[model samples]
Target: MLIFVLQTLAEILAGGTSLTSTKQIDFGHPIDRREEATEPILNVYVYDLRESKQLQHSGRQFERNKTGSMQTANVSWPPTWIDVSLLLTAWDKTTLGEHHLLAEALTILLRHRSLREEFLVPELRGHGNLSMTVAIEPAIEISSLWSALTIPLRAALFLTVTVPFEAQTVPKSLVWDRIVSIRNKCLPGSDVMTITKRVAIAGIVKNAVTNLPLTDTTISVVGTEITALSSEEGLFFIEDLHFGNYVVRIDCPNYLPQTVNFLVESQTYVIKEVLLTPV
Candidate 1:
């Protein structure tokens, strides 16, 4: 994904300016020796990459079905967003030529604050809308960056591109449509009667001491596989239950598991609040 982003940026600059194609734009370490034949070239180097903490999610596993149908998928974190830093430099035999190339490159980069979908590569296409920011580094930092590269300080454009790291997915169980039926039986003497009942349970889970909303906490119907995970706000719900006695269990890391017994009568909805003590 990182390489594809860099190549996309190079392509954008190449097409927008007099630089015909990506061939004129090279990707390598600036410290490497430049060939005389490849003079007046553009060099793109990736300097750093880090995951975006703001977009991080706690879940690590995801599930999806191969055939498209009415199926439920346990998708973990969709994809981790990462920030990649790139350095673009113009290398030439003459200072004038170098400045000329740099000027063209800067003009192209400045024209578009973000790379659009039309400019993305084949591998990146249809993933989603992705945009990259193009900006110049401060003059004071340029010296340190070049020093780190162990090369003489030269004019360069610093580019920061945000891209997604693909997540791992596994095939899970398939879901099928559910059907329910009710039949009425009448005795020889009198009248027919019908009965209908439904129940829904909703609740919030929190830390006992901190009272902070605990996300990814699993709440399940005791003897049944039906379960729901608490959201970031610590809210969870289990619906479409028949009236009966049930024991619900809550399990979360670093917290003592809890089980609550409740009897559902003719009520349509039931609300409960749970606080888990730290183990």
Candidate 2:
């Protein structure tokens, strides 16, 4: 029997979730000088890592209570802001089970309160549950039974959270560990998945004048959008590259963009280094 597990960590920003007043009611209470009602005001802002940009000019209203005790607001039409985002990293993809694990990890993030406020609540408001579809650049093909069993289960887990007015404050180090545990829980057995594809692709990035390993340089695959940075040791790993042709781009302010094409084949790997020169 083959067992698969999913794992992921979702970090929610502060103030990602909030409460808004939907209806104005007099309550037929005596309006006296002793008891004055403070009118509720609505505030909207972008939830990106950058400072909040007020959407006051957008003129969108808070959606009234759908039911229970919840009032919510919409970010904006067409969802122009990238405030809520996702950073997914797959440690293993050699087995079909790992793909299932990846799907499950993402499912956990979509429902996590911090993830919701950061990514989902901006667009959906009131008591309604968030509907999010996971999109990967280089899609993974998996079994019908796995998808049928995992997809809705993941969605149900996300719907179970009570949305908060602020992003969840979790320690950065704990985030990675917590998601791994959560992924294991979603599966039938095992705590972690061992990676089969671990290869080092080393190279030197230097100044045109002085040849050296360009420390702190970022290497990214165009199609997969997967990336890694060269260490002070001047070595980096593009771990777990799926089978395909990709354009590797190197970016540095002082140097011109370095673009190269490489192919990653199944069960086999390549070791190639790059040299970036100043323009």
Candidate 3:
């Protein structure tokens, strides 16, 4: 989950139209990364992680399905909110170049307040607990951090991301697979008459004017928590859907939101191409 958070955060920064696709995002110790750097880069270092003191809670959280069946995913123990602190520094050949990159990144960070469900992996989805704050003051001594890394203190942004830490990582698909495997074989005169199958909604998001793929666009089922983010090529696939009609909404940073209605009966339903006009 920690690694997913970092990767998603990087995608938000360097992917899509956020930054010029050429800018590289590197993670690890700044000193080590600096020596290996071959081009201008954004160095992200996760400096600290601790359970959030303000949002503490105990016990389990629960939810129910449309059929009144208890959703096992939500029936697990309550998650502990962990605060992840990241140190973001821009590395470039020239000081002016690095400063310009930082300013651009600052603008992007200020626009986002939460890690949307569209960006989270399957196991970490459902809960809207991955939140972010940028330009926060460092909890640790900045000078000490620089000294420990054996690098000079430089301009950097301290980003804090509060994430839910689950006691166990359970993929909902795996849970269903285990249950189905128990009833793997169906003999003659068997009571099993239905076989459950996972369904998907797949499509591409494109710029209305440029006709180019738009990455990081949110693809959400209007009435459900199901969501998926468009990939680098602008393709998105929301899986685990059952047989039903769905209302999907597409959203991106600068584009106007779009809504489309479609029916799903096949294992994979391809949504018509979506075009979003700039606002």
Candidate 4:
């Protein structure tokens, strides 16, 4: 997977900018890529690769698909952002010539926002445009990198690209679906009184015109404590509802609030077509 990502990066550099049809571009250590004499070439060294600390991630997500008698749950992790830092050094014999090559490379890369889809390999096509930033400020100190390579530092362009690393699904068996609770209380020398009975209500909220599921919608039973927030697929479940009439309220951003009255006569009630109109 790493190999595919790196190969695609090289393709992006050569295809998108002035470096098109240029075979002088190479990857790996800069010193090894330099010719013995003054033949100019650009070497791309991957100095750092780490998970981006900026992109926030939500909690884990799980989806279930039922097949005949078997039900399985698949855990889908969020796509991770891998920040790759590349050190672009121009290899030449003379200082003046090396500066010229570096300037050409930097000129071709400056003001670029993202890696285009045309240059993307098959694996990277649908992952969205790879965001990139190029500047003189290397992610790591140039002197330190040159010291490790046992060579002197030269002018280089630091390029950072954001790559999304997607994870595979892990399947597991589905557990029990429903659970109910009952509570009983007795007063001093008095008859036993039932406090509450477990009842459930579930439904999906959608756009009235588009008929598309609305995520992050809030569903609640008015005048009661039972409530639930809609999932990504617009499904909401309010558990432990009382066996009586309910005024359910649905609220979402940029959408008008809605209220519906329903009487629950059974343990489970599934409401349908709970649509909300947009403002």
Best by lDDT: 3
**Pairs in steric clash, model 1:** none
The clash count of every prediction, one per candidate, is 0, 7, 0, 0
TM-score, each model?
0.52, 0.28, 0.51, 0.53
Q: State in Å the error of residue 46, model 1.
A: 0.3
Highest TM-score against the true fold, candidate? 4
For model 4, the superposed segments whose C-alpha errors exceed 4 Å read: 16-23, 36-39, 66-71, 173-279
Q: For candidate 1, what is the lDDT?
A: 0.70
| TM-score, model 3 to reference | 0.51
1 versus 4: better TM-score goes to: 4
Residues 10-93 of candidate 2 have per-residue lDDT tens digits of 212112212122221112211221123243211111111222243212343333222232122223232222122222322221
* Residue range with the least summed lDDT across 10 consecutive positions in model 2: 1-10
Q: Which should have the higher lDDT, number 1 or number 2?
A: 1
Candidate 1's C-alpha runs over 4 A off are 32-35, 53-76, 138-141, 171-279
- Sort every candidate by lDDT, greatest first: 3, 1, 4, 2
- Candidate 3: C-alpha lDDT: 0.71
**Predicted candidate 4 versus true structure: per-residue lDDT over 188-250, tens digit per residue:** 454432223122566678889887778899887898776788866676666544355778999
